[model samples]
Target: MKGPPMPAPLSRREFIATSAAAATLATIPVVHAGGSDLLRVGLIGCGRRGTGAATQALHADRNVRLVAMGDAFEDRLEESLATLLRDKEVADKVDVKKENRFVGFDACEKVLASGVDVVLLTTPPHFRPLHLEAAVKAGKHIFAEKPVAVDAPGVRSVLESCELARKKNLSVVSGLCLRYDWGFRETVKRLHDGAIGKIVALRANDYRGSNWGKARQKGWTDMEYQMRNWYNFTWLSGDFNVEQHVHFLDVCAWVMKDRYPTSAMGLGGRQARTGPEFGHIYDHFSVVYEYDDGTQLISNCRQQPGCKNNISGHVYGAKGH
Candidate 1:
């Protein structure tokens, strides 16, 4: 006789809440826009990245206002709002009220329903697909962080949402900021115009020390703890390759005018990040991405202390270095 299959390790409470929230998400109608007066903005995931995005939005335009804020934790929301208000450029445009500062697993839903024109989704990668879908369904434009998804299923959802956003005339911009830099753009343009002839090989390296990993706080559930320290988890951050190193790899692809890698073979291991707080993510990876024409892209990333770092990308061709 076969024994019972092993159960998932997630907490029952977290599972029930997540399932219930997902089931009810379909009921949120695509409602009114922020109108033509002010470009009202709401921020989800009020962490360091979220605060930075909120400030940059205010500085980018004269007609924008930070109207609402939300986070999984109330303290984070408070800190984010404080930081936003403290910045000279952002303070004048800050208009979030006490009632509009939401916190919890359902905080994103509340922020989306608050009638904002745009939303900044700087949550962990695990929440990107969910938050993006919700933002699209709520009829709001989105500026989401990188590696839009942590898995293939989430990527499928994001691709579907992108099509829907197109139909709805909503803008969905990813925070792959390197693509927007003038210098990188100019170099890529020259490379495309035959400055780099007969491309031979490319290399992308994001070797760096440990990022912002945190030890578990007291009284937090496993799920809650993981969400807080998401960068350490593969399902949350997609490892460092997709989360951080995708930028350099994409630069190589852009220079070659190829949108994707045809094949990839790689291996990775968790070296110094062996503590429980580091979760299940690897500390280093070495992958070779092959194009259809046999060109291969070498990729590597390491997140361990006391190691030499290299956060650069290179393209090699017959005519140039």
Candidate 2:
């Protein structure tokens, strides 16, 4: 006997329109309407952000259930599960049995095969491309976090996976939260509506202090320590530029009507955090991106401690100051 018919893939125009309209939290699940009423959601990272995304997913729809979880470290997975269980709002929705709790490097694969309709890809940016491809191939809806990859190749892989997901009629939502924020949306809309005429230049900056670091234990290998403190490693977190400053870059792109940059020159260095424990990622970055129309985006980001903190962006136009 034949199973249910597959849904028609969205046209390019339809996909663009749907993505734009569903930029906010209220409309995220609207794309998954074709799924079963009771959606079985899986968490793949089990970190702080992973746990938070799982919580949000549970709250996004009443019928959604957290059925499976995976993480490289068993402790992280168990910690996240316990935290979810304690939350009154989504506690009842958490039903990850012991068998469904997977650990180690292959945990993502295990979670994908455990009968989940949706999966949250909150692993480090390094693992995102691999996990995204697997999820798309497995025909599961995905909610992937920002800076989906560590390098150009990884980014290309994510693009390919997204296109394939489109062909499969699977919903793939990104974690660029600014796009979903009401205030930022309104502001960007006004800019695009000519509140600022003929944009000429923009400035984006994200300056902050050092992030948390875990000291290496006696028996931990290099791989174990780096994995535990993934944010400090270039291969894992993709540095603060791709990992954290991506939000500002996204905003710049939005203001430019999604135009691609023609060329860019950047300067960065590791000054404050030079210890071995901090890995090899740079602490600061400044880049100037030029568009074909001569519009420029000057961006800067830093992760140093005990310094003045400033995070803001500005757009310059012919009619505005």
Candidate 3:
């Protein structure tokens, strides 16, 4: 029997075009800063994810200040700066001097050069590898959101970068927030202590909400807007399964103490949100992952409205002890 055909590779031009477009749509306006003597923090992307992350980082420590920001679009950088300075919680924590705001492709470089100790990489998955590589090279601790890469090539790059991060003793944490949750940790600990004697299989599910949707706006090129709203693109978001449900997949992997799955067979499609702007991502998916020891991990995810937010998983053991 023959195997499934591989996806066609994206040309360099296609990649650049999509990235450029997304950068423009997602740009935020910048705000002016107040002072110095603050622990400088740089944000590489200014989307909702990036803004939320900046707020959290500020709240995490008093010394930390959002000293610099970078985005492909000037508008996004400015908008993000304005929001941060306006939010009562974030405003007090940010120092948005003219010298601290940066815009354009090279803005990331400038932010790093400005003496940032920690960097937040919340760019689209397609651009994550590049941003992560730069942060690692600059010897800065990093907080990168989930779905680190969009494709096999990008994943390989991230793994290699992860290696360098370990060597540098940099605290490189993925945005898999569940790993930090107390309730989840308690359950995992019991299982490890023989609460489940010799695990055999596991199953996980994430069925909630509708896929991404965007309204048209002026000065936004198709490529730029496409990149700005990347959750719908496979090459940028790595498919809904990998992008959103990977948290459950990662949980199963963590419990089993494994990295790669032995083999996988799955099905996916676009049951809803079928539009030109919506690229080649499946709105629903089911995958079965088999481990070397014959243990199996089944994962399913769907993005349809009116569905309850139910994310749960269970591990089965031989003895059921």
> What do the candidate models score in CA lDDT, each in turn?
0.80, 0.86, 0.75
Alpha-carbon deviation at 8 in model 1, angstroms: 54
RMSD of each: 13.2, 6.9, 11.9
List candidate 2 stretches off by more than 4 Å: 1-21, 24-36
lDDT of 1 by residue, 29-112 (tens): 233335454678899999998898888777755667789998999888998888887788669889999888999989999999
**Compared with the true structure, what per-residue lDDT tens digits does model 2 show for residues 1-321?**
243343455432353335223442224343344344567889999999999999998887666789999999999999999999999999999999999999999999999999998899999899999999999999888889888999999999999998888888777888998886667777888899999799999999999998766778899999999999898898999999999999988988888888979999999999997887788889999999999989889999998999999887899999993
Whole-model lDDT, model 2: 0.86
Those runs of model 3 whose alpha carbons end farther than 4 Å from true positions after fitting are 1-38, 306-309
TM-score, per-candidate, Cα-based: 0.86, 0.90, 0.84
Q: At residue 26, give the lDDT of candidate 3.
A: 11
Across 1-321, the per-residue lDDT of candidate 3 in tens digits comes to 243343344432232223112121112212233344345679988888888889887875455678889888788888888888888976887986888778877877888888897788987788889888888899876788888988888889988887887777665767877766557766777787878799888999998878766655789887877776778777778878888898988889778865567899998888775776666677789889898888888888988777677788889987772
The TM-score of predicted model 2 comes to 0.90
Candidate 1 colliding pairs: none
User: Best-fitting candidate, measured by TM-score?
Assistant: 2
Looking at candidate 1, the ten consecutive residues that score lowest on lDDT are 19-28
* Number of backbone clashes in candidate 1: 0
